[model samples]
Target: MDGLQAYGAGKAGGAFDPVTFFQQPHAILRIINWLFSVVIFGCIANEGYINRPTEEQEYCIFNQNANACNYAVFMGCVCFLCCSGLLALDVRFPQISGVKDRKKAVLADLGVSAFWAFMWFVGFCFLANQWQASKPEDNPLKEGGDAARAAITFSFFSIFSWGAQSFLAFQRYKLGADTAIFGDYADPGQEADQGPYSAFPGETVESPPAGGVDGTAGSPVGYQRQEY
Candidate 1:
């Protein structure tokens, strides 16, 4: 009756490790990266090209430019995107599942991967096409700086995005035919035997440490009211 067993993502699932198979962290990381892209990228785009030296000022993403416009809007969009992805992955919107939606998600994942790939491609061309400096006018793009930044961003997204998708695809191939796909699976040694956040009723459980054994304990972050 366990899900992901054959059809779901349990024992019947394809792999024992969902993190490697599904790349849960990488997927979550995508959301975080996009967050920076939105807040940082969009803000710079809005400021347009300032003169050159002061242009670095335009590159600034926070403060003075933290208004609800430009970068703020882009960051909001990225936030919505990541949140939506989490909801889907968590099945929080099971009531809204459909083939079209699933396929769309797949395509979006692929598209992002391809975009990152293209960015790297362009960056390579930048280095490849560097002009010889006989006269000082060599290498027109002055893009040396921009090229480096683009390369760094492109590398980060390319590796993470494509790597994650590659994992999903490989898992499907490995366990797709008569195999199981598990978004999540538990290991008795790793998971709590009680259950989901399982705490036995009428039993007081000892708290875990911030970075101690299994790291499962600790109160919720933020201010805690003390008892009188």
Candidate 2:
């Protein structure tokens, strides 16, 4: 019976669920999904299934097909390799009283992540473009327009991945927003409950019982001050 009111429909304290709030971070979910989808897309593009067998078939799923899979693997490798650098940034800097320290940490990590992202972008960009520009006669996998288009598309996803990860890195690692993810940290009502509800820390809350010193009805906590 008592538990019913504790969790019942009310605006005071029942709505906020702390467990679910801290356990989940939505930003991480979206980027991982995007990375996986792009990888699979790369693999299926050219039909290079297992081994690069110069065949004249269209439905080879288990052989070296030299299709989208080859390039997808290539793109996935590069993107994750760069993403790995973000681990360093994800570490936190302890709070200092006067001078700020967290922001400095983020700036430091940003420098490292940006470097890795740039290197990965350059290597992937050059190779992908070259492969895209190659004539089909040289390699039956991708050539001319489709090759270039696919390479460019993959590059776009790669850049997006880096940028997305980089931006999220600032909030969690550098900005110290991660500490406040669950919110204020102090007691939720401690700030606003300063007047009647909370007198001062260690201060007594003395009040007469039901019919007070003035013998009048009172509030829930049993109190009645002189009216006149």
Would you give me the overall lDDT of model 1? 0.40
Candidate 2: list runs displaced more than 4 Å. Answer: 1-26, 33-75, 81-109, 140-151, 171-228
Candidate 2: lDDT over CA atoms? Answer: 0.44
Q: Candidate 2, which ten residues in sequence have the lowest lDDT sum?
A: 1-10
Q: Where does model 1 exceed 4 Å of error?
A: 1-3, 6-23, 39-43, 46-48, 52-120, 123-160, 178-228
> How many clashes does each candidate structure show, in the order listed?
6, 16
lDDT at residue 109 of model 2 (Cα atoms): 51
lDDT per residue, candidate 2, 33-99, as tens digits?
3464355345445433322257544432322234434545565565455444433223212212211
The digit string of per-residue lDDT tens for model 1 on 14-119 reads 3344355345554555555455445334433543223235344332212122231232344335544654564355332122234234334444544554554454
TM-score of each: 0.35, 0.37
Predicted structure 1: clash tally = 6
